[model samples]
Target: MTEFGYFLSSEEHGPQALIEQARMAEQAGFTSLWISDHFHPWTAEQGQSPFVWSVIGALSEAVSLPVQTAVTCPTRRIHPVVTAQAAATSSVMLDGRFRLGVGSGEALNESVLGDEWPEAAVRLEMLEEAVQIMRRLFRGEQVSHRGRHFTVQNARLYTLPGEPVPIDVSAFGPQAAEIAGRIGDGFITMAPVPEAIERFRRSGGGTKPVAAGLKVCWALDRDEAVQTAHRLWASEQLPGELSQILPTPRHIEQANELVTPERVAEHITCGSDADAHAAALREYVDAGFDTVYVNQIGPDQQGFFDFYRTKVLPQLNGA
Candidate 1:
């Protein structure tokens, strides 16, 4: 079954607001949740970036649905030992219903600590090493690793989950997908590219769950929704490696100038047409994703939820 999930936008909502949204998602029939882990929002217009671990703790208390970090970068901004501890604590709090979704990461968030960002190949290598260290820590073993990219001295987590947290790797390219398959418990991507999924399966992913997240704007007026999506997420449309290499929101905003409203409208599912939204989600389902998470853009959160609850989800789920 292709489960429907809601993507909590940590970049757009405060911690309390995110908790409330999680509750609403559960009530509205979403099967799971995906929250982003970011040190910084992509652009200033999006506004909020709470500590994801704190938000996850509150979510454990607020919703029974499973949760996963849409993706967290364990390589640079935080050590894998600390990330492991945080993830283990989160999994215990959620009653072993949490997943640690990881990636090589982007400079917009990872570069904040003034560390020079490594290139893609190095970043992926560091990520592989970090995952090994984290898996050891999750087993309540004291880990002392002195690797090429990191060092951990006799670090152990006392508070642990009943089971080791599953780490899902996010990849958009073949190289990252290969790494994800070779090392990840599962695979994640933004688009519904069957070839990438096939590559992952061949590389080593096998039958592990595959998940993807997509954004939609559910405004009553199509043009209004398009403008909101364009203003808030234009940076997402930047070409090539710009998203991974950009150092700050300001630089990202400057780069966002290249994305036009027409492009956003063409690419994003906007407006109140239920069929359109259903069709958009169907594309991912058709691509063989086990789970698809949808994020509603702009301030019409309640409206989007209501629309999905009444019109879209029923159609998708065949309820």
Candidate 2:
């Protein structure tokens, strides 16, 4: 069965609010959770970026649902060895209910550490090496690595879950999809693109779970929802590689000036039409995603949960 999950927006909500949201999501029938790891929000209007590891620690205490980092970049801002330790501890805290989702990363989060952003190919190379190092550490073995991108000496994870933590790789195109297939336990992507899914499968992803996420706004007023989504998530509409390459929230906000409310309405599912929300989710399901996560764009998280419990999730479960 395809599992429905909640996408926790670390960029938009405070840590306590996110913990509450996770509890609410489980009550509302969300089977899992996808949390973003970021140093900053995509736009300043969204206005919050708490340390994701701290929040994950809190989530373990507050919710029973399985959690995964929607995608964390282990190559740049933090070293892969450190990431391995964090992921290992998180698995223990969650009692082996954690998966690590990794990717090449965005400049919005990584550039904050004052490192020059590498090209996509170079980043992918770094990510591959990082994944290898992490996998070794997860095995409870001392690791020594001298690679083209990173170095590690006698690194080991003291704490580990009973089972090895699964790594889900995020990809936007075929090349990354192939890499995910070769190295990842699962695959993650934002869009419901069949070609990408097929590429992953053909490249060796096989029957492993594929996950996708969507953003919506649930409100009584459709126009108000649109405005809220545009105000808080217009940066999402910036085209091409901008989402990955842009270095700061301010830069994202400047580029998002071209994203009008109408555009936001056209893309993001907004308003309280349960059928509309279900249809939006169905796209990812139809594309063969085994896991789908929905992120509410603004602050009506409670209302969204209630709506999903009453009107949306039932239909999706039935479907």
Candidate 3:
């Protein structure tokens, strides 16, 4: 059976609100949880970006569900050494239920430090080094090294759990998926396209778990949901990070003019019905993902989870 879960938006909700939702999600019968880790919201309209590590700490006490970073980048905004410490601490707090999902991040988060965004090749190189450093740290070993991307000076994780946290990679296209197969303990992705899965396995992913996420707007009123999603998150539907540095929400509003609600609506599902929600997520499972995470956009948090619990999940998971 395919595992079902929810992805909380840290950029849209505060840690307290998210903890409440996570508790509710577990009560609603979801088996796992994924949380966004972002330094910025990319647009003011999206509103909030809580420190995810702190939120996860609180969530550890609040829910029974296992949690993972939907994805974080250890290479850019935060060095691998710091990320290693954070992951080790979080793993201990979760009592060995944490999965660290990492990726080569976008400029929206990383470029804020005023460093040049390296090409994909360089980022992959940095990611490999970062993962190596994390493994060494997680072993509670003193690591002192000089690598092209990082230099760790005798760092060790003193607070790790009994087992090392599983590291999942967020892969997009072929090359990255192959790298994930070669290095990652598992794989996380948003794209449900079957070609991506085949690429991952062909490149050496083996029988490890594959997790995917899909964004939707769950509202009893479909029109209101779409409008709200477009108003707040349409910038994400655009191809790149040009709007992230534009300084204000109005700048994002202007850049969004080149794109339309129709474009955003095409990629996202918005409806008051449970069948629509199930159909949307079934695409991911049908494509062979071992686990699927549904992320709801806009507010109506209780209504969204309630609808999925009563209507969507049962149909998909055949409860």
Candidate 4:
């Protein structure tokens, strides 16, 4: 069965709010959780970005649902060795209910440490090496690596869960999907693109679970929902490579000037209709995604959760 999950927006919420959301999501019948890891929000209007590891630590105590980083960039800002250790500890804390989701990363979060942003191709290379190193560390063995992008000497993870934590790799295109197939336990993406899924399966993804996420604004007033989505998530409407290349929240805010409320509504599902929300989620399910995570775009998380629990999820689950 395809599992429905909740996407916790670290960029828009503090740690406590996220913990509460996790609890409520579980109560609302969300079977799993996906949380974004970012050093900074996409735009200043979105506001808060908390330390993801700290939040995950709290989540271990608050929620019973399995959790995964929607996507974390282990290639930059933080070294892969440290990421491996953190993920291992999280797995332990969650009693083996954690998965590590990683990707090539964006300049918005990765460049904050004053490192020059590499090209996409170079970033992929770094990610491959980082994944290799992390996999070794997860095996509870000392690791020594001298690679093109990073190095480690006698690094080991002592606090690991009983089972190895699965690594889910995020990809938007054919090349990254192929890499995910070869190295990842699962695959993650934002869009429900069949071509990407085909590439992943053909390249080596095989029977691994494929996950996707979408954001919606759920409110009684459709117009108000549209405004909320545009105000808080207009950065999402920025086209092409801008989402990947923009280095700061301010840069995203400037680019998002071109994104209007109409455009945001067109791209993101908004408004109060339960059938519409279910239909939006169905697109991902119909695309053969084994997991679909839905995120509510604004502060009215309770309203969204209650709607999904009482009206949306029952229909989807029964279907």
Q: What is the C-alpha RMSD of each candidate to the true structure, in Å?
A: 0.9, 0.8, 2.0, 0.8
lDDT of 2 at 141: 92
Displacement of the residue 168 alpha carbon in candidate 2, Å: 0.3
TM-score of 3: 0.95
- Supply candidate 4's per-residue lDDT for 117: 97
Work out candidate 3's RMSD over C-alphas.
Answer: 2.0
Residue lDDT tens for model 1, 144-260: 889998999989999998889999999999999999999999999999899999999999999999999999999999999999999999977899999999999999999999999
The numbered model that scores best in lDDT is 1
Regions of model 4 farther than 4 Å from truth: none
Model 3 per-residue lDDT tens digits across residues 173-275: 6778999988899988888888888878877888888999988998878888889778878876766446434544556667887777788778889878778
lDDT of 2 at 23: 95
What lDDT score belongs to each candidate, Candidate 1 first? 0.94, 0.93, 0.85, 0.93
Worst 10 residues of 4 by lDDT: 310-319
lDDT of 4 at 171: 97
Candidate 2 has its poorest 10 consecutive residues by lDDT at 310-319
